[model samples]
Target: MRFIPSLFTLAVCSSFSIQADNAETAIERITVQGDLRQQSLQQLAGSIAVVSEQDAKRTSAQHLDDLLNQFANVNFSAGASRGRYIQMRGIGERSEFVDTINPSVGILIDGIDYSGLGITGISDMAQLEVFRGPEASRFGANALAGMLNLTTKGPTATPEGKLSATLANYDSRQLAAQFSNSVNSQLGYSLALEQQSSDGFIDNTYLNRDDTNNIDEFSGRFKVNYHPTERLALQFIAHLSDQDNGYDAFSLDRNRNTLSDEPGQDKIRSKALALNADYSGLGFADFNGQISWLTADSDYGFDEDWSYVGIHPDEYATTDRYLRAREQITLDYRLVSTPAGQLGGSDWVLGLYVAGKDYDLNRQFWNWDLWQADSFSSSLERSNAAVYGELTTPLNASWSLVSGMRLERYADIYSDSSGNAIKNHDMMWGANVSLNYQVNNQALIYLLAARGYKAGGVNGDALAKAADGNLTELNSKASFKPETLYNAEFGVKGSALDQSITARVAAFYMWRDDMQVKGWLNPDSGPQFAGFIDNAGSGRNYGIEMENRLQLHPQLALFLSASWLKTRLGNYITLDGDNLSGREQAQAPRFQYSVASDWYITDALTFNLSLQGKDAFFYSDGHNARSKRYELLNARISYQLANWELAAWTRNALDKDIGVRGFYFGNDPRDGYEPHVYEQLSEPRRVGVTASYQF
Candidate 1:
């Protein structure tokens, strides 16, 4: 609370000392793709943040997680080798086990879905947009909380190429290169490749290995654009990624040291292809279509007991592993009416979407000390079809009305090695309505109401269901109910000081019914735990967000963003007789903010500094454990000279102990079944230097 006043004071004081100058350029027009259409940022009704390629380079961001963590109301759970799970406004999943999960947030890269597996390479990205509310009408069930859209650099008519290399502490090395050009007047192409490796920041004393938790990644992307005729355009894109990383992170004493004998692996290999086409031959409307396919194979395993065999001779030491392979295909087609007055001064869009997914999982549990092994496998196939439409009409000179709706049908089939089969079907719907009023050329205000939906799925843990000893009970618990969200928001966007300053503020409230929540259950009084998903009664989340950018001078700029969130359960009760009606939702922080400043010392030199902070929050619903509030500092310096650039950067410059993930459960036998809090810390201070050349 005290920090809020200080931040405002600093902003006010800085404004007084800064003078506006036309010599410096301000970011006046930002184009964003939020609803499958490009719209100016100032005209958007919802809360969104955009990170450009220049910003990513200034911060020396190597992955999507690095660029996203600097924004307000955005956080990640890092139980794996990297930040694979994202939480927006405190609504997202932290981890996944045997049970199937419907992600609250959706991730898209060049129109291909990568929901739970967002480890795709982010090199040479043109821009990234983060939508902070339910995008129901645009994305349907996959975007209950929000969405992230990443656009890669497109092909250019002029030939150009870039090569860069980086070296950092802890034996880290990275190399990247890209080339784009036009082969002829009608065709253009682009290619990019990147490889990075590091001896990660963890020490395993038991195994005497300093590089037990290493990171190795490789990625490549190719894009081609062809304009066959004056009214037709076509594009093809392909991407491939391979990540092989270690996961020995936890320590008994909650520090940077581990004693696990069987360190685990977190690996993923993915390939994706997309084709897009547009035709404007019809004078009444424009047609656009996209076809995409993605496949990924992953192996995630971890040490069940973070200890050596001799530490607890009587207790069993185990390792749990899961191998998963997934394939997805999608087709989308839309037609947009051209000319505002084509249909009585109104604009409209109609779209059809279809998607199919196949997922297979194999789990293996090895009790090394006890010489026992258990194995299980499951497969799931899901299909979805939807039709959506939106209409925008002007009510008067200053007010406009927009309405949209989506109707979708989903079906899923699940089967496991235990001879259990489950089939389910659901019909989901989403809608949105908004009213916009333009106060002036420099300001706009809007109110929006939207609904979002997610389909349910069958539980994949066949062994746990069989252990219930009742076939009827097992069948009844096989499926969970769908979840829905209703959200309302009011927002304002404007610019001042001759467009030298731009700001946006929004407040939103969301009510969720039949909320899907995850928890672990103990079928018997043993050390084993079975994961399950069930529908809670209801929940609510309300929050306010503000973002501002000030171009103090041509050589200096300042940026600030903050959010305050509150979440609570309503009439929700756990299976263990715990009344969580009034309890706060897990991972819901009270406040989060970020401040950054950039200074150009000279025509060839620049410096940057940033600060990010987050308030304490609960870890999960099953436990009352909480994480401590923390802040991080980062700095960067760069020098440019005629097609060559050199930069140095440091992350976590202050070396703060920030917890990225946490758990509250018993794992060590020496503690005699006493539950304690365990946390995974973020990376320590890392210093690196990069050099790049463009031609």
Candidate 2:
């Protein structure tokens, strides 16, 4: 079945039918991550990909995760269970908590950290930048792997507004509205709202339900910009989101599985507010500061009766609340500026960060009052401060060098379920060096290497296991050790054919220390269960990423991207004496690629087609592996009138079948040989129509 798709891909690339091959168009130069202004894709010095609002609209991307999942060079183990994580240069770890995200990858929106991934109100975004590798030296602690920056749209020059509605299969409906206006010359504001709901695609094998698998989400955002003067500006933004969704369904014959009780229900809500002030051109000095507050509450519960009797004889519920309040102030001073001279450009930025979070987890068994587990409460208080400076000097006409370093100190205090205190402190330093050479106005190449660090915390899995076993008390293992990575990259960006085509290629290698892996346990019960986290071993990831855009004609364009990765563990130490050494990483695949093309068929009509492919990986413990390769096709045809635009799109056009495999508990040890099952689950082939009007 997979071979047929491979042949089809080869045929498509081999065909000489130049329907619209090798075509690209030049767009405006945009500054990504609030620092560097990339004039063209060819001039970017790092591994970066930009998706504009126009691109988002053309693709009909409903969520941030959906957009990143289709892009090349990015892979994530995401679903109803595993939260979102950025996988670039092959570094990804699953962290299920909200107050702390083990993202080697960081996410930012308009210069503020977007700490919560479960909240769904990420609409009205103007641009999204995906940066990989050590280029994340500019962000905070969560940038060990990469960074995702989403910049929302600001007030328009005129009073511009849009209303859009979409209807799809599976009883799904979506409505969105955005309005922006200038209250006066110095004040402006924008407001947006979005609501979406869907009847899920999976059927619960136990509950025998249809609509019970549905999801509902609502989100809203408001932004106000005040420019008291040309050099000083103030921005205030607030957003709120709520979601209700069904957990992943269990596989058929789930009675034998330990965790395979009936499907669960999840309710999540979040609020974010930020106020920022920026002042520039202050006699060779500039300042930027912001204060933000974030709050998230989640409730998830599962009933354990539909599939099996006596196993998990009651309903289990877990509720968590996370609150984070942060304040950051930064000042930059520059003493030298020259158009063409050495030691002309030197800058320094000093920043102070104060942050604190309150985290609490509660668990209870409904039927058995004695078998209850709940957190009295827990809180993590964190604070950090840093000062960084960068100096860019031009050695000659075609050569330049940049050097920067940062010094930081951090402190953290954790209160356990009983309000017992645990404290830790650390001081860390980071540095970066980059050398660039420009061949011409349209080409540049550079070599970069930098180090990144991510702080660690308590092991939720281990704690949960010990608590369920009715242990008297457990001493906290001084939080997991921080994982660190050193990245080395070489890249070149260039354009040709009168700047109508742009291309970029980069090769990177990273060595990670103190890697984390999950270890499962064996239990004797109606439902067998136990699991924990361990610093299993070290790992290495190396990969090459390349993307190209060519403008073949005025009406046609072509874009292609592919990433080849080699991810593996260098050493292994098992917690349970399993001797599972020298095995490939469990859930990470080694190959992912994508291709897309756009054609302007007429003045008011356009067509887009794209295909994404992913390789296979082991399902269970790297012993019983199941191949998970699938090719997905998507297409959109859009039309525009004077004041309205309409699009008809189809996702998963080929209706490819995807399988998620897992293990099952067996009555006898011998019966476990064939107890593995494959759940033929998918998002379904969806056809949608969208209509939008502008005023």
Candidate 3:
């Protein structure tokens, strides 16, 4: 409550803080690299948030967990070993247990798909961009809602090397090193390696350990660029991440302490490679092509009962584990019309994309009797083929027109050891059209309309389990149909006060048909929960997003980002009559906001302060429980000299208890299976110091 006055003061002063500072660095024009071609972000018709390289380096971020509050309307699910799944605009998956999912928010690193793996390292990222709309025309169905892109640092014209280290409470530590150089005018490369580990915040009273939910992560990235001829250029990127973490999160008391005897693991090892080539030797058009491959192996499991045996009379003991392997390959090629190929003064682009992916999963469920335990395995193969194109032209002196379309054929095959075989195929299309009006030299107003789609998916073994239990009230459909979304948006964006201030404001509305909603069913009569997806008739979401920054002086800058959103679910009765009609969608908070200020006290001293808040939201579609509204504060201060720097930072400075995940279910034996609000908590107060040296 005290911070509200300070926020008002900063907001008022920032409006009048536009005085020119000769020494202050001008807010330069930013180009989004994820686009088909280089484009100025300020002039784009859609909404996006681009975190510059300097902003990433200014924080004590080791992985994605530390950077959540930096973006508005963005959230992540941490029910597993990692905070892996992400949500944008309250649209995305919260968890994955049995069925294959089509992600709403796509993720990419250097244009290679890494969706659902949200906890990537940030030590070497040059920039981070989050597009907050349906980008189907650009990236196809995977980008139904939007995309998260990370562009790592590229080779430098001059040779440079840096070493950095960090130490924090809870036995947290990290070490990283990076180097980049151009050997010649025709060749260049960059390489980075990092290792980070921490004794996570969970305390296990039964095991007498505080490191039960620990973290051990390693990451590396390498990139190279070569120009063999005057008209051709080639680039290559390789990335690897190995993570081994514990997942003893859920507690009987819904706090930091745990009593489970067997704490499960959340681990993954992934390797990916991408190659791209650009050529201009042709006369009619230029060629751009990309191909990539990714492979990953992961294991996720947890103790079914929150307490160990003997804690209660006749206590049931159980554990569940899953091992998954995934492989994916993708190719994208584009032809950009040269001046010679332009028709009627309009530039155009044509593209072809093909992707294939394979997923395999093995699950082990152990009950009290080893002979009665169950084993399950499943295999799934998915493929996508699409042809997409775009055209841009001047409609008038003040208004420009941009339109694009994509046609994709999606196919998948699934089978399980339980004699269940299912296949799904769908033909989907998406398109967008926009008109940009140049209001003046410094501002632009635009209106856009777009359509997006998500392919249908099967419920794996959950369907059979439901039928076996004769749960007639549960969703009877073995598979769900495709989902389509129609969106309309308009906004004004540009610079002001001689490029000292940058602001973007937008309002958007979206309508969904055949919406896929999450539901739960008891595989047996016991207190067990298995997830499934059911198609609802319709839904809608509308919101406004605002982001602003002002340079008060050469050494001071202030920023504000906020969103007001509303969502409603359609009438449907799945999950034994738990119809969530007319209710707000889960995880769709009504309001979210973040405020920050950066200041350089002296030539060698710097300070940064930030406050972030989010409104209450429902945890799941199958339950009525809601998370509490909460606010967090973070601060960082640094001192630098010639080629050396030292900094200290703290997150959740007030040590507030906040829930990251919540559920209303009955799991207690003593209470006779009475439902209670169980939750997984976020990390408590964390303080760390970092040092870096450059050579």
lDDT of each residue in 1-695, candidate 1, tens digit only: 45545444443343333344541354256889656556678766788899898877766788876777677788788868888777888788888777667888888988889888875567688889888888878887889888888888889999999999999998999999999999998899999999999889999999999887888999898999999998999999999999999988888768989999999998999999999999998888888999999999999998888888998755657889999999999999999888932578888889999999999999898632245898778998999999999888889988989889999999998888877787889999999898987654445678999999888988766344544353223443567898999999987776663656777777789998988776655544345665667677899999877788888998899988998889987776655556777788888888888888899999999999988889998877656788999887889999999999999999888888778888877776776756778998878888999999999
Could you tell me how far off, in angstroms, the CA of residue 196 lies in candidate 3 after the best superposition? 1.1
Candidate 2, 338-366: lDDT as tens digits: 23322445434444555555555554332
lDDT of each: 0.82, 0.62, 0.82
Error of 2 at 226 (Å): 1.0
TM-score result, candidate 1:
0.94
TM-score on alpha carbons, each prediction: 0.94, 0.84, 0.94
Candidate 3 residue-wise lDDT, 274-296, digit = tens? 99999998887899999999999
lDDT of candidate 2?
Answer: 0.62
Clashing pairs in 1: none
* Off by more than 4 A, model 3: 1-27, 367-371, 466-475, 523-525
